[model samples]
Target: MVVAVLLGSVRSDRVGERVAKWVIAELESRGHEAVLVDPMTLKLPLLDRMWKEVKNEKGSEHAELKAKLQPLAELYQRADGFAIVTAEYNHSAPPALVNLIDYFLEEYFYRPSAIVCYSATPFGGVRAAVQLRSLLAEVGMGSIPTLQPVPAAGDALSAEGVPLTQQLAEKSGKFFDEFEWYMRALAAERKRGTPTGTAA
Candidate 1:
């Protein structure tokens, strides 16, 4: 399956990049195609209008907005699943990540997503993951049951973006197993034109 690994932070010293790299490597190692989607690089402008409004507007009236969002929409549409690497900011997710998720609704519909939540503290950004579950659900995306939480993320990864310990590596493996199962199941369901909520 083609999975999109989202680097959900844009801070100068963000550790989410390292987490995202590790996720991509894991997915590739398992023979899955992984694409990196960085909100920082995408640089999507803050949402000024709701998606429904843009859809209802005339072509010329929303041309600029369409241009900015088309690439992102296409990427998400092609992805069978997603792995969002996020950090908790003030007990919530970063606004940039939220903005990226808000850019398209239909692209995320019926797709499955996994969460890799990391933080400097022991909680490992679980709050952000919890909030993201709700947001992704609203967009008709199902989340894998196993959430990968890396506490003290800066220490959990090596400078080369590899897992620093066997325990961490094992946790990642289990998470990927669950993620892949959902990805394949949902991808098949989507292909067979089966209804969204009918899958196991």
Candidate 2:
């Protein structure tokens, strides 16, 4: 299955990178494709006054951002499911993510998406997860009931750093189980919509 993994923050020093890396490994082990979409590495100009008005047409002020958004749109459409890893900055979804979300709609429709939020408290950025869930639903993406909120965000990672008491394998096993279901259910739905063999 193609699972587009979005590290949904533009910050250079994001804490969720570890989580994303971990998820990628789990997904890959199950013979799935996990593509990373890092907003920091992909730059685009301000999108307020231009893209909305011109709407991806030629010579628009935000033509660059509009053009850049196509790949994201394409990826969203191509994937069977998605896993979004994001950071919380004051109990809200990051503006960069919000704006990019505004750039498209139906591309992400009718798919299952799992959310992972990390922060310093039990809230575990759950506040931001709530906001994101609503936003994603508005665009027609169904959120899986399962969520991973890693409190003390930076505390539970193991890519070469001092590992935690809980074995990484255990945590990954649970996460992957849900992801596998999400991918299968959503992919079945998508496949049903596709035509087979010669047109009837």
Candidate 3:
């Protein structure tokens, strides 16, 4: 399956990149295509209007925005699932991740999302993951029950996303297995048929 790994943090010295890199590598190792959607590089503007709303507006001003967003729309639409790597901010999910996801709705329909939350503390960004469940579900990529939390992310993985400990690698194996199962299952179901309101 083609999975988009949405990196949630854009902070200058953020550790989320390391976590996301590891996730991408894992997905690839499992024979899945992984696309890294880093918010810093994506540089999507703060959501004033969704892509669905913007695409229908007729004007030169909207044309430029449409050109910029067209590739992203294609990528999201083609993805079979998403793995959202998020950080905690004041006991909630980061705004950058939310803004990146809010740009499109139908692109996410009938897909599964996996929450991989991380934090500097041992608590492991569980709060942010909890908050994301509702948002992801509303967007139509309902999250799986398993939440992969990377505690003390910097220490857990190297800057290049190589796991420093056997425990982390082992845990990730189980997480990826569950995520892949959902991805395949949902992809099959989507092929069979989606609900009446599903996207074409």
Tell me which of candidates 2 and 3 scores higher on lDDT: 3
- Candidate 2 deviation (Cα RMSD): 4.1
- Each prediction's TM-score versus the true structure: 0.88, 0.81, 0.95
> Residue 46 CA error for candidate 2 (Å)?
4.6
Residue 177 lDDT (model 2): 84
Minimal lDDT window, size 10, model 3: 191-200
Worst 10 residues of 2 by lDDT: 191-200
lDDT of 2 at 77: 72
The residue-by-residue lDDT of candidate 1 on 28-89, one tens digit each, is 99999899889888777798875655755776977877766666667777888988888999
> In model 2, which runs have C-alpha deviations exceeding 4 angstroms?
49-56, 59-63, 158-168, 194-200
Ranking by lDDT: 3, 1, 2
lDDT of 1: 0.83
Q: Residue 93 in model 3: shift from native, Å?
A: 0.6
* Pairs of residues at least 3 apart in sequence or in different chains that clash in candidate 3: none
| C-alpha positional error of residue 130 in candidate 2 after TM-score superposition, expressed in Å | 2.0
